[model samples]
Structure formats: C-alpha cells, structure tokens
Target chain A: MSSPKVEIIESYCKGCSICVEFCPTDVFEMDGFLAKVVRPEACTKCMQCELRCPDFAVKVH
Target chain B: MAFDYEQYLRPGKLPHIWCPGCGHGIVMKGLIRAMDTCGLEKNNTAIVSGIGCASRLPGYVDFNTLHTAHGRAAAFATGIKMAKPEMDVLVVGGDGDGVAIGGNHFIHACRRNIDMTYVLLNNYIYGMTGGQFSPCTPVGAKASTTPYGNPDPTFDIAKLAIGAGATFVARTTAFHATQIDKLIAAGLRHKGMAIIEVLDDCPTAYGRRNKFRSVIDMMKRLKEIAVPIKAAAHMTPEQLEGKVLTGILHQEERPEYCEQYQQVIASAQGD
Candidate 1:
C-alpha cells in the first residue's frame, strides 16, 4: 500500500516535457532543461513517463 | 527501475535520439516486456533492422543486433536464421523502410515462412529523412513530399502478410501498451513467420504535417480509432471505417523454411 517510486535519470533527460505532458497523474515537473519527479506521491505507475520518454530518462517503480 | 529494462537495454546507450513524444519508445518498451515474458535469452536472440527511426531500435537493445542497410532487415535476418536456426531472430523496421524500398524482401520472407518475428512500426511517413509519403501513408494525408495531399493508396500490412503466407499476423497501436506486449510475445512464440504491425506515432514528422496538435492528440486519436478484432465483427462497415483492427488477424500451422531446407540437405547428402 505504498506510492509508486519514480526516478529521473538526469543525464538522460533532454527536458522535452513529454513526461510532464503525458502523465495522467501530473507527477513530473521541468527544472530548467531537465525533468524532475516533483510529486512522486502522485505517481500512478501507468508507465507514461517511462514509455513516452524518447531519451530513456524516466523510470517509475 | 522495477522492470529491469537495464537487463535488456544497453545502459550506455541511454538518451536515445528519437524526437520527444515519438511512439517508437512505447514500441520498444512493449518489445522489452514481450522479451521478458517470453524469457528469451539475450545472448541467443538476434535483432535486425533496416534504416529508419524504428530501425534504430536494435542499436539500443543488448541482443546480437545488426543495423543493416535500408530495406534489407528481413534479408539479413533470414541469413541469421539460416545460419543458426536455434537463435531467435527479430526484425524491426519502419513503414517506409519495410514496405516501400524493402517490400520485395518482406513478401518473400513471409512467403518463406521462416521461424522469426518481424515488428513493423508504421508511422505513416518517412520520418528520419523528412516527412515523405510512404507506402503506408494514408490516402489524402499531407506529407513533405506530398505538398497538397497524398493520392496513392495505403497498404493494409496485416492483410498483405496474411496473403503472403506468414503463419502468424497481428496489429496493435502504441497507445495500447499492454496489448503490444501480448502480441509481440505471441509473435515470438509462433513457430513460423510472425509479423506484428505496430501503428506508432511520429509526432514531429507525421503529426504536425497531418494537423495533429500534440503527441497526446495523436495518442487519443489512435485510441479512438482502434477496434478489437472480435468487436470489429459485430460492428458495421461504417463503424469500422478508419478504425484499425487490433489483435491476431491470422494464424496457421506450417512447415518452417529452415527445417525444410535442412531436410533437403540431409537427403541430398545421403543420395
């Protein structure tokens, strides 16, 4: 009964905003040119971040 | 990650080159999941691809991958299967790469009914070399090459594969993530040739030209248009128009080419 863990690989992030735009739960935010999982608690583990990230930057556990 | 994508992907190859919101990543994820579910040994699997955005997939995977020439992935994969029939061979290519320049090789591969799985990503245009019209490009759709609108007919890839004699054929879209994984696993397990056509979204190249507002818009459109094969039977032709039928379209048992060829070789040697 715990929230899904979301991790963002900074080096791989191109800050394309795909994860921010696609996540139905609004779990990510852009920090400059990189994406950060601001609301890990909101993570639904729907895999939108991981699947839509062309850079292979996001991982939702 | 809990999925262990690292085990299947080349971690050093992180930060892939696909455009933001491109559907190729979704397809890759589905393929990885399929591989995991099938319990395929990485070292024993051979991945082959022709030139295009989808073709770049093999470069990121950790298997025995060959980034072959444009439109020749199937031909190269055939050689790998012939050399070592024990190895699981998977061919990946885009619509333009697989059906346009490589159309001849594709049909022949299906006709041969070899033991291999082919994952064809149809984004409806030539994405890598600019938004050009491709064989799968929809009629009346606009592309860079087709300034006004595309006039050529589009190919129903699944029907073509079934007609060409592939033992297993299926279709799915990037929006249907879980279904993509299931279909890919089914394709891999099939004895003869299995062709899985994935309707992916090329947001930058195909979406913009086609008047799609964003990646989400394209994904929603795919969701709206996809109809399950079983459900399609109950729907009218009007309801079916513009709707892509997902799930296994055709499948049958048949003799695989490599095994037949080996038998021929043994008989000739005895003679």
Candidate 2:
C-alpha cells in the first residue's frame, strides 16, 4: 500500500525548494520554481518539508 | 574513522566545543543510538534545536537539522509536525531555553499532545553563555547572575509536563547513557508529547558554583541526590530528602494533534 499523501497547495508554495531537496523520496517536483507534489502517494508524512519551510505557506494535509 | 558512534562524531571539532568533560556529548550520543534503534532513516529524520550550548546539537547531527532561535524548538517542531505529521520530530534544548523562555510553548505543546519528542538537557545553570541562573538552577545555587545564591526556586520539568497535560514524561541523567537511549526510543514510540529531562553536568557553571572539584565529582553529586522516581515513591522521609527523581513520571494515551487536526478538517468537509 502507498504511504500517507502530502497535499501541497501550489498557490501557497513559496518555491524555496527546501522541501523538494529534503524529501528522501522524490515526492515533490518544481513547476516553474514553485513546489508541486508530483507524487503525493510517495509522501511518508515525515513533514521535513513543512518544518524546514520558512514561509509556512505549505500545509501537508 | 572506524564504524562506531565515536567514528561518526567530528574528531577535528572534538575535544568538543563544550567545556572539558561536559555531559552534553554523552547525551547526544545516546540520542543517536536511540535513533539508530528506532530504525529511523537518518536522511528522513528532522532534528530541531534552539539557542544555548545544548541547542547546538542539530548542527552536530547528520540529518535534516534545524538550528533555530533561542527557546523556540517546540514552536518550530509544532510547525514541522502540523505540516508533515508523518515525520518524526526530535527537539533538543537546555533547561533555560526549553523550560524558561520556551516554557509557554512547552505547556501548550503538552496540552495539545503533539506527536513529537522533546529532550530537555538540564545542567542547572546556563553553562554556555556564562553561568547565569535559570528557572531550574535550584533555590540557593550560586551563579554569575546570582552571586548571593539563588533566591528563586527550581522547576521540576517532568512534574511540570505532567501538570501541563503531556501524555508522557520521564527524567534521566547523562550518566545513565543507555537508559537515556531507552527513554528516548520510548518517547519516539509514544503517540503524543513526550518530555524527557536528562540531568547533565555543567562542571564549569552549576558545578563550580555548587562546589564540585571536577566533572566526575559533579556526577557523584547527581548520584547522591538522584533517586529513581520508582524508588523515591517507596522511600520514607528519612531516605528522600533533597533527592532527584529519575524515571518515567507519567504516561497516558490520548488523541494526538495531527489525528485531531485531520478530524477537524474532515468534520468541516462532511466527507
């Protein structure tokens, strides 16, 4: 079964790319410098991306 | 250079930035071991820290480390958990940072019962930025700021957590390194807020002011004063004066912040 999904709200994404770089699995991809959850199912719900994001724009739910 | 914990430790940096024989490194090592035992992927873990010597831990650990502002590890950890919720969050800080300035955050985190582990390194005094007195420096201890001996009483962090609604609370010392790992691993396994206070030796500050000749002497002092909470529970007044309690002080199962948050949105959506 797939792991927990991390829904990334694109408009809220500031695109610092910290989350993209932090996730162990390539769950996130950059779309014009904004973070896109290309593989939400790949998200392990570790929250490393959310925690490290300085903007607080991204919400995993 | 070999494949041991000491091997992973930065030798060039060592002799450690902490004062000679300070217990912070021992506590850090125990934390690493606990992480190893949990089968946590190093690259997947998030370690957060705040200002203070003990808070400098995130930089030393080879993970997704966050070295944040003073006394804000819990606040930061909250954001981390709320956002991802699946990732394990470990907050590391000292008494002054975690309990005093960050005390409010600590209480709120406990009340909310967030799914995270907080390791509080209590060496009594603010050993890093100078021997200043803190909320847990104990009443009557001398510090650079409290030359006449401290007039303010100390706080028992584990007791405070129990009172504030933390689902789990435990106390241990750096000297009990293996037990420290077990406690940390247990906290990681817990579903809600788990506060582990690790008593440490600040030989340069709390020790010197309190009159210990060396770090070993300071450990001896902790040995004499520390009574396992279990043992203390059965001790008579004759055996329990001026004793520290080292064991799980409280534990309870409760709904954690993440699951409750998901419920909130689910209820709102009626889905």
lDDT of 2 by residue, B102-179 (tens): 889889988999999999999998888889999998888899999998999788888899999999999988767668
- Measured by lDDT, the strongest candidate is 1
Candidate 2 residue-wise lDDT, A1-61, digit = tens: 5456565655445554656766788888878867787887777776655543423334565
lDDT of 1 by residue, B1-271 (tens): 4567888888678678888778888889889999999999988999999999999999999999999999999999999999999999999999999989999999999999999999999999999998899999999999999989999999999999999999999999988888999999999999999999999898888899888988778888888989999999999999898898999999999999999999999999995
Candidate 2: the clashing residue pairs are A45-B86, A45-B87, A46-B87, A47-B84
DockQ of each: 0.51, 0.01
lDDT of 2 at A21: 65
Cα deviation at B10, candidate 1, in Å, is 1.8
Could you give candidate 1's per-residue lDDT for residues A1-61 as a string of tens digits?
7778888888877776778888998898878878888888887678877876766678877
The positional error of residue B204 in candidate 1, measured at the CA in angstroms, is 1.6
TM-score of chain B taken alone, every candidate: 0.98, 0.95
